[model samples]
Target: MITLTGRLICADAAQAALVQLYLPDHIRLTRAEPGCLSFDVVPTSDPLVWQVNETFTDRAAFDAHQTRTRESRWFKETAHIRREFRIIG
Candidate 1:
């Protein structure tokens, strides 16, 4: 299994609006994918930061997620967003 943990940071007040607008779609699409074990978006104490916690069955599943996000218009539009990820043991 592979876990993808990350925090997404948006500029100023745009975080909440972006989360409300785009997170649901990301959740629905990612969770529905074949190898997705879980996909969740959580709020952070800082208004401009949000966390993304995702698990996939394997590396292939992770790759698929990368492809989907890269091709997504929503992600492209939010290109200014900053993110960081860590691998879990």
Candidate 2:
């Protein structure tokens, strides 16, 4: 299995709001993906910062998820996010 953890910080409220706006679709689509063991994207007290936690059945699944995500509108929209993330077994 692979677990992905991260913090996503937007530039400001407007950017964060953009994330908030599309969050439902993002979460729903991601969770519905194949081999998605778990997926959560939640807001923090600091509105600009959002927490991310995801798990996949394997590296291949995770890689597939990455590819799909890159092609998503959320990816194009949040291209300016400051991300701090890591993957673990």
Candidate number with greatest lDDT? 2
Overall lDDT per candidate, in order of appearance: 0.82, 0.91
Residue 73 of model 2: what lDDT? 93
Displacement of the residue 43 alpha carbon in candidate 2, Å: 0.9
Residue 78, candidate 2: Cα error in Å is 0.4
TM-score of candidate 1 to 2 decimals:
0.88
* lDDT, candidate 2, at 38: 96
Cα lDDT tens digits, model 1, 27-49, are 88888998999888888898888
lDDT of 1: 0.82
Task: Give the Cα-based TM-score of candidate 2 against the true structure.
Answer: 0.95
**Residue 21 C-alpha lDDT in model 1:** 85
Clashes per model (N, Cα, C within 3 A)? 0, 0
Candidate 2 positional error at 47, Å = 1.0
